[model samples]
Target: MEEKATSATFKKETVQRLMSLHFKDEKTKVSNDALILISELLKLFIMEAAARSAKQAKTEENELVSIDHFEKILPQLLLDF
Candidate 1:
């Protein structure tokens, strides 16, 4: 089956602003392709983290995923990053 293209979870302008803030003192400029890649990577990371969090909640017999679920996955998510 073919995969469908989905809209990115992050806004391009927002990502650009964040990048600027992160490299405020640096003279280097971020390229559009690099920005796009960063946004896509961020979306992928969020999706994976949420999925894992939901699984963890289910495994623990919780009906709803909560902050604790996300906290539990933070270390793993950071490692993935």
Candidate 2:
């Protein structure tokens, strides 16, 4: 089986809206490239967390990745951030 290519999952307009809300108090403008980069980075973060959580579940002989797996990795994830 061939693996499908995964594109960034976030909508640009939604991300732009979020950015606008984040900086609503200021006169700052978010650029298109910045929004794209932010979306890509968010995707990377989520992918990394899911992979790690899956690994944790597998290590414990569990078939399903649960919130416990995510909780186990949260501290390490925050450290990376």
Candidate 3:
């Protein structure tokens, strides 16, 4: 079976604004391709973080995911990226 690709979850204007803010010192424009790439990265980062946090919660036999679960996985998650 072929794996399905995930769509970009963020909007172009949001990514564009973020890029502009990041480069506030030097005015610059983000290309359409780069915008899509960054939006995908942002989505992946959040998804991975949530997945890892949920697993952490399951490990401790918790039904609902919480900030503590997220905190536990944060260090390793940041390192992974």
**Candidate 2 on 6-36: residue-level lDDT in tens?**
9649999988888888775778888889988
lDDT of 2 at 81: 68
Candidate 2 vs candidate 3: the lDDT winner is 3
Question: How do the predictions measure up, each by TM-score?
Answer: 0.83, 0.81, 0.83
- Cα misplacement distance, residue 3 of candidate 1 (Å): 6.9
Off by over 4 Å in 2: 1-4, 24-26
* Number of the top-ranking candidate, with lDDT as the measure: 3
- Candidate 3: what lDDT? 0.88
User: Which 10 consecutive residues of model 2 have the lowest summed lDDT?
Assistant: 1-10
lDDT of 2: 0.88
Please, what are the lDDT tens digits per residue for candidate 1 over residues 25-67? 7786888898889999888888789889999899999999999
lDDT of 3 by residue, 4-63 (tens): 587648999988887887785665777899998999899989988988999999999999
For model 1, name the residue pairs that clash.
none
